[model samples]
Target: MKTGVEKLTDVMAHFLGHTAIRLPDDVIAKLEELRDKEDHPLAKVIYRTMFRNQRLAEELQRPSCQDTGVSQYWVRCGTAFPYINELEDLLREATIQATFETPLRHNSVETFDEYNTGKNVGKGTPTVWWDIIPHSDQCEIYTYLSGGGCSLPGCATVLMPGEGYEGIVKFVMDRMTSYGLNACPPLLIGIGVGTSVETAALNSKKALMRPVDSHSDNPRAAKMEKLLEDGINALGLGPQGMGGHYSVMGVHIENTARHPSVIGCALNVGCWSHRRGHIIFDKDLNFTTDTHSHFVYEEK
Candidate 1:
């Protein structure tokens, strides 16, 4: 018989595996939209190949990208979650199990020792970020595979207040133009604005969790999102950087009020694969997922 945490571990492992093999519905929809907007034959061919790759991935039940990326979890848990105390360990074990079950590529290496942990659980492998929800028994989890090519050019800096929001635009555009092509085209861009480098950097990653077609709740931020998306598409990176009519799937901004003197901004990019999963769990561990809604998990 499995313990409560053990059951949760199996569920998480299954979800992680599911995430590796599939793209979210929103991402697929946007990709199809881009494919239709292009007139270039090569771009059309590339888009077709992309879909074929996804089809093969699902048919074979293999990861869509060999990189598979570093497994990271963004967990929003209620304070009253029954298994809250053991959640961290549960996640770590789940990652290890998924690494083998999904046959994921080993992507976690210790910084100085420089040895791959192999199990996907090391000193800080499978990085987990947490949020506490008050007076609820439900938890929301986002799992992402942060690939090296996409994450390599991630950057952050603090700007002088005088530079203003326009400065933020310049910073993002500069990075996208310089490194965006290498990240794979039709990238999902996440921009974070806060009071410091770390804060902005973290928020930038969180922005990637948003739906590709969604806009910010704030009107100014929503406008900025559209502006950035348009500017990036204007780059004409096309599919696989071969060049096309559109360059990005979308741009998302996650911002927080900063100190009066400084505006910190950071950028995180997600490649075409953009493997991530969103799952909500009740206290009893009954879970539902939107990212891989079509997936059928095998019961332990």
Candidate 2:
């Protein structure tokens, strides 16, 4: 009989491997929507090529993007979850397994030592962010493959209070104008505003886990999401920056109260093939996910 650790490890490894090869359902849907809306022949052609790539990636059972990226996990677990203590290590082990099985590129190198770990799990690779629940018996995991290209232009900064919300808009637009093309476009932009740069940065990434069509509960932030989406699309960085009618898939904003003195802002961008997955497991290890359509796990 498989232990809970072993079973969960197998499931997570499968999910990680699946994430590499498949674009999530929402991502594919959004891509299709963009492709249908394109008037530029070049942009349409590029979008078709992208869909072709996705089909072949599945048929060939290989990653859609070579940079399978460092595995990052957002674990929202309950205090009453049976295996909470082992969750982090299970994620690490699963990442190692997926690296070799999914044939992910070795992207983890020690910062100071500058040596690639090869296994995709270095000292702090496969980063795990935790959200602890009070007394529930289930956990939800968000898996993201953060490729170097998409992560390259990520940045955070503090704006003087005088700058106001307009300053936040300028910061995002400035970043997009400067290096947005570096990340493959029709991008998903995550914006975070909070008390400090660190919080903003973290929340910016977390914003990426939100559904593409969803918006913040806060009405002002929701308005910002629509406004930024429209503004970025106006940049016309469509279809790998070849230029077209749209520059982004969506813009999501997350914010918290900050001091009177400064406003912290951060931006994270997800490329056209935003590789992310979500799964939930009950105490008995029964699980469900809709991120990857028609996914079936074959234990080997």
Off by over 4 Å in 1: none
In every candidate, how many clashes are there? 0, 0
Per residue, candidate 1 scores C-alpha lDDT tens digits across 218-266 of 9999999999999988888888899898888889999988999999999
Q: What is the lDDT of candidate 2?
A: 0.92
Task: For candidate 2, write residues 227-260 as lDDT tens digits.
Answer: 9999988988888999899888899998888888
User: Cα lDDT of all candidates, in order?
Assistant: 0.91, 0.92
* Model 2 spans > 4 angstroms off: none
Error of 2 at 248 (Å): 0.4
